[model samples]
Target: MSEKTILVWFRNDLRIHDNEILLEAVRKADKVLPVYCFDPYYFQRTASGISKTGSFRARFLLEAVADLRKNLQGYGAELIIRTGNPAEILPQLAEQYQVNEVYHHREVAYEETEISEQVETALWKLRLNLKHFIGHTLYHKEDLPFPIKDIPDSFAVFKKKVERDSNVRPCVPTPEHIVTPEITDAGELPTLSQLGLDEIVDDPRATNYFQGGETAALVQLHKYFSQDDVAVKSKSSRNSGSNNSSKLSPWLAVGCISPRQVYWEIFKHNQDGNNQNASLLKLELLWRDYFRFMFKKHGQKFIKAKTAEDEAPVLAVNELDFNKWAHGETGVPFIDACMHELNATGYICNQCRQIVATYLVHDLKADWTRGAAYFEEKLIDYSPASNWGNWAFIAGVNDAKESKYAIAAMQPKDMVSDFVTTWQPSPIDEAGDLMHV
Candidate 1:
């Protein structure tokens, strides 16, 4: 009998550490092949006129993939890189590598699931199985106390039950060595220009560069967990004039580190399970699980479908207010500061994100999906469920009354401070008091 080979396809789960799909492939087959596809669909400019993957996100992705390849090399394997549809790329790689099966972590979002289905269909024709592993969530889906269908719509109730009843599974051990067939070519990593985007000129104030990789992710985790103000930082307001909040989201978004890894490290550092600061940090990770599980339970519930060509921007109004908000040109100082930081660094504090989002939907009376699409393009930490779910909540599905209240409560008293001065447009737009003129 010939030796069996399994191709491990890398999606959001980029790291070898704590990755079950990588382990399962190695355990099941005699040799393992690791691959990451830069699917063009993700990099394309949608009709919404927003990039599917913007400069910041695309660059971060390239860095993460490069790091993954390097890590795989350390473990005695090469990361096979390709730029194309996964549906086309996987089948071809399967044939080239003589792979009996292909394994990947499952995704809950609509487009990701659709692409997975397409790849599954293509593999079916070649008589190779497309195996999927559920490794993205901190808690294994099977271990959940309630089924996806039964998950409470209210986040409060959901958090309560999961904490009380469920247990987070241990991290999958990283293999000492990953075996692969001799390979002459593994393809080149694509650049931002190739992905149809301008190069990123990072803002000067961005002193803390977010390096992408499991290596960097682990470093940041250790440093963040070691801080004495873990509770204060974990509960840091999303509404900040500065961009110096937590840095774990981009790593989490790219899958350089698993939520389980972070959770366990907190457990180790805190020792006692009942530590409040540790619980808050874990709660932050739990929010990620909440959005992902919510997506699984209900598909695209928050997004309103486009009715006609008139709604071509697709998610929200694509007019002046939207463009101004996207560029941080809006006259409102605080909102402008947050948007500028987001546009420049691809990140902003959660408090600022909510404030700016509210300004767009409530103050500006523009559609909410527009802000969601912009974030989808610019945010380094953009996850479909979290981005869209938060936007939907801020958009206030029940009524405008709730958003009105939220905006009033969130307005900063000292909006004219130095943080705003640093980010707002030069010359201060004499009428700076204006809102999105």
Candidate 2:
């Protein structure tokens, strides 16, 4: 007779610590199976033929999965690896392993929701349980002051109410006892080459050093707060491009890190008398939660042109102007600089992100989808909700009914003067190199 087991489906939450789903699986089942699937749908080309996940992010993801597997082994747990549609494969595994229930963290984006529904249908047909936990944000879903439908439209309004009315619950502690289920054979994770991508070395011009997995993320948080004196400069330098931001986005995006983990770390620091910068750090986490809350409410409409109206006007992908801007040859120094950084490194500062996105939509009169798709491909830490939500905001899609932000060349120069100087084109004699006002 096959042994009964609980399959903990590892989606984005990669760490063993503070993992609600994994911990719950341990609590309820004698045998627990850990699994991760490298869904082919992720690497496939889009309608426009561009890869959905570009090389940089692919490299980061590969490292993160490998790290997660290593961490699982330390706890005597084996990570099952597969490459295919989860809806089909998961049910097959459930039947084979006799896994009665599948536990995983909730994913709120368009594709993720659809995929989850398919998995649920498949599991239901087999009479198995699919239990999803919410462990992504600093704020728990059930603890929200309002129902998701009643989530506020304006960020200030939402933050004010949540801050005043809600409390940041302490994170679930990492269980000390871990039980690894017996399994005969587990597959290996895909490598960079197996994914049809080459390994990448960090670019010298890159501002932040980004890594994957939970340990790296926690180490970073510790270093930033304790060793690197990051807390001291929280207000002044967190906005700067070169090594300013927490550089936590990539891990968070892939579930290698949890926002609650970051929040509690900051909270601990504040309790230890590092109170001066605690509020600012907490605010950053709140912003992340805000994006997620918005996504939960708007669904796929967050990426739509008007959020409830017609899709945004589509622009030709091959238009000369579009190609130039996409390739970082816009001939505008500030825009070109920020774009070049994105090309060299898969990241751009939050401030620069807003500016370039606005320029693409409002200034160039390009479709928001074009810019949004490009970001989906390139950004290392790209979250579906945040990218699309911010794009819609800049494109006048969401709650910003009348405030359509069009980027002009002057805006870039004024906002990011030093960034322009840093990535100025070589061979100063060329007329094209000149920064036209």
Cα-based lDDT at residue 97, candidate 1: 80
Q: Write the per-residue lDDT of candidate 2 for residues 1-437, one digit (tens) a residue.
A: 56558998888887887798988888888888888888888888898878788889888787788888888888877888888899998998888887889998888888988888889999999999888888888788888899999998777778888888888887777766666666676887777677766577767765466777887978877775673254353544433432333556777788776777777777776766545445655666676787788789877665555533555665654588887887788877777877877877887766567677777876788887788899898888888877777777776666633332233223665655454534632211111100100
- TM per candidate: 0.87, 0.88
Clashing pairs in 1: 238-350, 238-351, 238-352, 239-351, 239-352
lDDT of 1 by residue, 95-170 (tens): 9889999999899889999999999999999998988888878888999998889887777787789989999989
Q: In model 2, which regions exceed 4 Å deviation? A: 1-3, 198-202, 227-243, 271-277, 305-318, 400-410, 415-437
**Per-model root-mean-square deviation over C-alphas:** 6.0, 5.8
TM-score of 1: 0.87
In model 2, the Cα lDDT at residue 51 comes to 79
Model 2: colliding residue pairs? 12-255
